[model samples]
Target: MTDAITLRESTPADIAFLQTLYPAAFPDEDLLPLVRSLLELPDVLSLLALARGVPAGHAVFTPGTVGGHAAPVALLGPVAVLPRHQCQGIGSTLIRGGRTRLEAAGTARLLVLGDPAYYGRHGFAATSDIRPPYDLPREWAPAWQSLSLGGDDAPMNGTLRVPGPWCNPALWA
Candidate 1:
């Protein structure tokens, strides 16, 4: 753990590590199927963080479209870090790294359904301009958030059109 953390785009070889890491990071959730599907997509960006050459954390960004936005849009989800790696800034590192890559690629907005406090610290704010694919619970409203990736200031308004894997209603809740 003394080695400086390094970031890299995830590869197929990293799937085994992700399978083990996801469950450990989210014991109550099964995110493997979604992760696997996202990896096979044509435009998804999956990032990996390594500490001392071992996988420390992973983050996935799936491309989507906000009806009115001419630029690119993406969703960040299921960001996972091993329990032992928690609070070491590995998760934050993965997030910022992914955003940096996406922004450079002309991605306009990044969406996430996660903890407001944690994501808020990373610049995600509750956005009324765009809506989630499925209706969110009243109390869970704040969990749906977005960050502008230096794309454009023009407001976008539309439901996020995600890939087939993320169409599951269960995941929306």
Candidate 2:
């Protein structure tokens, strides 16, 4: 593991890097097309982690609506770090940096389908306080964690809706 890594907002030039890194993290059949579609959404947030100038991981955040309210929530997904870079904090940095940027932009909450053990370090928790649009499997639901930028009272519960092709069931599956 390198002593230092760089985190940045993915630029148009970084699409290739994302394309390369995502598959390494998630070998799902629907991921590539989902990536392509997510790139076109106006509310999408994409980030890249670079180690020694080489892309090591990628993370994507998409705006979601809950319970018919326009809650400024983000759905984090596909946070992928190269197998070699798994435990070196690259994933954590990418997630933290992305959340920081979103919070800076006035986003209120973020939702993620990932390990609570991993995300909990960043103030994420799985509370029955919020509900997603679709029913997530029990195992997956336990991993659903939320982080609030505006404090605990911020509207945290609602159905999550992603724009465009991201709404497809296959991608969420």
Candidate 3:
């Protein structure tokens, strides 16, 4: 069996490691700077996953609005697993921790942009009513998805108000 993995609130000390981790985990995406900015946002929730006392993964969740809806929502992104620890369920563990924290915070829904198949496994699906503020390319529409955690209310149509790091157009493309 694998060693028990622990999730912890990220501290300032973890910043340096995350500065290195994001780039290494996403070599082609140049997402390190964006991840760094997100980490510093006061309204964001930053978490780190440790396996056998080693930093194995990280996830960033930031508060965002559904424009006109009073519905509470959060954005999930830039989740990363150390290269050596990938495919070992470390990423999955990180996500579970995020979900629990979000639920505890009473966040009704979560949004992400990625391969639907992957996020779908975590109970996220494509949402038509709520869309990102920016225009996603026609073909990539399916990548913009959301997951309802504890709400069965009617859908709302509105734009997402994200933080500065997420304002960059590159993220939606």
Candidate 4:
């Protein structure tokens, strides 16, 4: 039987685990620093998923704007699950929990560059109109999906910019 998974706001104690988990997903040195900067941003939302008191996965979301609307949208990314924990629904649990928290806080949208098959199960759909920043790969582009909590009319088209080091050409590329 699987142990219960718990989702919680990331604390300083979780930083070490995050550092370790990040490289597993994004091996690029530039990406790490950029991720670090995003985690430190005031508007960023960081979450950790644990199973039986051990870290299983992590997720980060940053504030963004879409289609000229300044709503509190999130750039979901760098979510990583421990290799041993894959297929156990730990990642999905974290995502659902995080979305619930963000929705409760009045967030209007959640955006991500990930697998359509995976994120789609969580209500994420690629926007026919929206586009991510120029630095992301085309494959990643196709994976750009959004979940609108503010009804179907929510704006999806617009530049999605990460709040910190992600803006740096060196880091973004």
List lDDT for all candidates, in order: 0.89, 0.77, 0.84, 0.75
lDDT of 1 by residue, 13-98 (tens): 99889989999998998889988988988888888999878898999999999976677899998799889988888888888899
Better of 1 and 4 by TM-score: 1
Lowest-lDDT window of 10 residues in candidate 3?
Answer: 148-157
TM-score of each model, paired residue for residue: 0.95, 0.86, 0.93, 0.84
What tens digits encode model 2's per-residue C-alpha lDDT throughout 62-127? 887666665577888778888777888898888888888888877778888778888899888986
Q: Candidate 2 regions off by >4 Å? A: 1-3, 28-30, 68-71
TM-score winner among the candidates? 1
Q: What is the C-alpha RMSD of each candidate to the true structure, in Å?
A: 1.5, 2.3, 1.5, 2.6
Q: Give the TM-score of candidate 4.
A: 0.84
Of 1 and 2, which scores higher on TM-score? 1
Q: Which pairs clash in model 2?
A: 66-159, 67-159
By the lDDT metric, which is better: model 1 or model 3?
Answer: 1
Displacement of the residue 82 alpha carbon in candidate 3, Å: 0.9
Q: Worst 10-residue stretch by lDDT in candidate 4? A: 164-173
In model 3, the runs with Cα more than 4 Å from the true position are 1-3, 151-153
- Provide backbone clash counts, one per model: 0, 2, 0, 0
Rate residue 149 of model 1 by lDDT: 90
Residue 65 Cα positional deviation in candidate 3, in Å, after optimal superposition: 0.8
